[model samples]
Target: MSVRKILVPLAGRAEDVEVLTTALSVSRAFEAQLVVLFTRPDPTEALPYLGDGVSGQVIEDLMQAAREGADQASGRVKSALTKIAGDAGVPLAEKGGEVKLPSVRFLDVTGRRDEVVAAHSRLSDLIVFGEGTTGVAGGTALEAAMMSAGRPVLIAPQKSWNPVGGSVCIGWDDSAEAAHAVTAAIPFLEEAKKVTILCVGGKELDPGPGSTLADYLELHGVVADVHLVDAAGRAAGEVLLEQAEAAKTDLLVMGGYSHSRLREFIIGGVTQHIRSHATIPVLMAH
Candidate 1:
């Protein structure tokens, strides 16, 4: 399905601006409305923790500081969205004979990050999150946004990415999440001239599931090739990367399989490996 509306969770960080730009590009290509959301922590939630030792004046000062921080973050997010929209030729207003360009709406939300994102997801066709700019925290935010939103999330790594083109790689395992990822990625797959479904496992494991997905794609008139890797000695992530490199793939579409509630911990084997080391951009769905 085509994405008609995209939600981008902005953190107002420099790195996140790049991710927002990429999201805008995708939105423009799809002729979609881009909703930029930023979350501000609620002030009332902080007052309960203030001890008796901290006077009323002190608490008020702290609250004011927090509000100021939120306002600053909101301004930065709005500025970035405006800049990107202009870059995409989305005009702010009409001139004498010129048509005004499409504009993005910046939403300043207050509450928990996950909760805010979840609410926005109900109204958006897709959600885009940036891989954390600061080590583990950033990665954790990206993962949480995807899980909480219950929608497709495109995670842009810290490394450089060219304009996404060429063959698309689908990391298949036949799970429900894999199915969702495949369905969510149809827009990209339709544009890709070539598509590859790669399953890294042995004969003892399931193979028919991926084949069925390939057949489904064939029904949709998409030309896809399926490959099964034995996973002889290398890790699954390593094998997947090797194959992607060999094929010169620019984007990877796969189910983000994980069981950890706190994604910052990196508890699961496959999830940990892919989050920390995947070389290509991953379109992940839980």
Candidate 2:
């Protein structure tokens, strides 16, 4: 499938520049449309009933703070988007149809950040995230996107970078998620200067995923290097990061391994770990 639409959530964090830049880069490479959001954190979600004797001023103070924060976030995101778009030569086109540069637009959403992101993500083909607000706030948004969007999520590192998929590493496994990730990443894989399929442990090596994926990639005219590592009781996410670092890969493509919570939401294990600790960018799918 093609990456024709990308969604990026701006949480008013410091690292949003990296995430937004990455999204624009991908959009440029794929001629995709970009949808950005600065989700307003809902103060009412935690507004407790402070009893009948509660002071109205106290409630007003809390509400004011939340709105002020949201307003600041919106301003910062708009300013950054404008600068990035200018640098990339994207016109401020209101109705898309920017053939030379990616079309960009922002949504003014009000709700719990995570819920707002998940609901809006349903319209995107891919969701991109930067280092998430340095807390569960980012984690919750990532989880919501993965669980609800039924698409891929590209999580960027906390640090800045320029990874145009010139070199890539694939964290290989034999699950459905893994297969989906590979298919979802075909565009980048095809353009990569170097591509490696990495497998850890016996089960992953049993089907010779490294070779299998290499062969499959070969059909698309993408030459890939297959490498295997001993799991040694380490988490798959950790092992993949190690191999990616060793190979000096620009990007890591992997499956988002997750379990359903409340039978409707998702809480990922490897996906969450990699998203949190990765120094390079990760492209994930479920």
Candidate 3:
């Protein structure tokens, strides 16, 4: 399906601009609505961290501060969203509510950060995330979105990225997760200037897996070149990266999955390898 709405979880913290801008880039690629969900920390959680002598008034004060900070930070977020959406100096007041500017919308959601994102993402076509910019929710919200939202997520690297769809590479596998991922990534593949399906494993490329997917992409008017790569004892993730670099791919489409996903992240697996190593953006749908 076409990506019509993208969910970007925003914690009124640092790197908000970077994350929002990355969402904007993806939104522009598909002319999708950028649903910016601002997740503010619950002030009551601060009580434990407070000094022993602190009272309810201090709690109230912290709540007030959080509200004020959220307002100010959200304003800046809207301003930056408008600017990056293409029309700058549009006056912050005009940029407040929903405008025709960039299909940009905002919602102030309170609760656990990941829960909020996963809840709202049910209506979104895709979820976009920054590298590791975290707040009170910590950094695992992306994983929550992936596992709970039942949708695809585009994870942007730490550095700035633009024109994310051009020159794409797919890490092809026969897993259900891999299949779902490629389908979720169809919009990006359709928009890419060049599409390369990199088949990892020691097997030869055939009509069953990689070539079959290539054929399916062709049906959608996406011409892809399928290349089989022998891992040669190397990790599948490493093999995918080698091909990605060789092809100069800006984005890699792969399954956002792992058996015991957490264990895969720490021990050794394709997910872990790419999560730790890939230089380009990875669009994963689990």
Candidate 4:
């Protein structure tokens, strides 16, 4: 699918710069609209969680503090967005309209950050996130975006690069999840100058996995080079990372594997490892 609208959630933290830069790179590639979502925590939402024993004065104080925190965060986030847009030569606006490539808008909303981001992301073509965003609150947003929004999520590394999706790499495992990821990444593949399909431990499959994927991409006018690598008892993530880095890939497209336990979703080990260690942007879908 074409990526026309990209969503990036910011909490006014230092990492927002890297995330914004990475998102902008992608926006430039697709000439897409970058929506910077800043969700302020609703002070009133915490009142019920505080319970009835809290005195009126204490509740007021807590609410005031929450409001102050949100205000400070909003200021920082806006300032950072302005500076980044200026440096990248991208236009910043409060409203969307006819604009140049890599245009951005700051969206301010009050509510639960994760829920708000997920709700807004439903309409977006892609969601971009920082690698460090896999933490508690960020992890909640990531999970919601994948499970609820059902959109492709791009995890940007701490460091930012230009011309994202210029050189694309795909991790093919002949799994349903991997197929979904490929479908979601068609736009990038179609636009990429170099495309590589890295298949790990695929020698055992009856039909060559890499050849099958190559044929599929050919149908889309995307010529892909297939590389078969032996895991050699190494973790799949480790091997994939090594190959991608060797190729100097700008984007890595792969499946996000997860399972439920005790009513909670846990990211698969390989996916988690790549998120934590990859130095380039990773596009994933569960």
Poorest 10 consecutive residues of model 1 by lDDT?
92-101
lDDT of 2: 0.78
- Tens-digit lDDT track for model 2 on 169-276? 998877788888889899999889999888877444564667878888999999988877887887777788888988988889988854444332354456656766
Cα error, candidate 1, residue 21 (Å): 1.6
**Candidate 4 structure quality by residue, lDDT tens digits, 1-286:** 6888999988888888878887887887888889989899888877788888999999999989888988898888888888888987888754445665568888889988778988998999899887554552247787678768888888887777777888999999888778888999999999899999998774463438889999999999999999888888778888898999899999999887643422233535667677668788888888
Kindly report which residue pairs in candidate 4 clash with one another. none
Scored by lDDT, model 3 comes in at: 0.76
- Over 4 Å off, model 1: 91-103, 133-145, 159-162, 203-207, 258-267
Question: Which regions in candidate 4 have their CA more than 4 angstroms from the true location?
Answer: 94-101, 133-138, 202-207, 258-268
Candidate 1, residues 157-231: lDDT per residue as tens digits? 664454553578998988777788888888888878889999988656577876898899987778888888788
- Segments of candidate 2 deviating more than 4 angstroms: 95-100, 135-137, 202-204, 258-269
* Candidate with the greatest TM-score versus the true structure: 4
Query: Clash pairs of candidate 2?
Result: none
Q: What is the C-alpha RMSD of each candidate to the true structure, in Å?
A: 3.7, 3.2, 3.6, 2.5
Candidate 3 residue lDDT tens string, 1-286? 7877888876555666766766777877677778877786677776788889988787788889987887787777666666665552222223455554347776776677878888887888888776554321125677777788788888776666787889999988877888888999888888899999888877554647888898899999999998888888888888888889888888899886647676785677887677666677888877
The model with the greater TM-score, 1 or 3, is 1
Candidate 2 has a TM-score of 0.88
lDDT of 3 at 89: 23
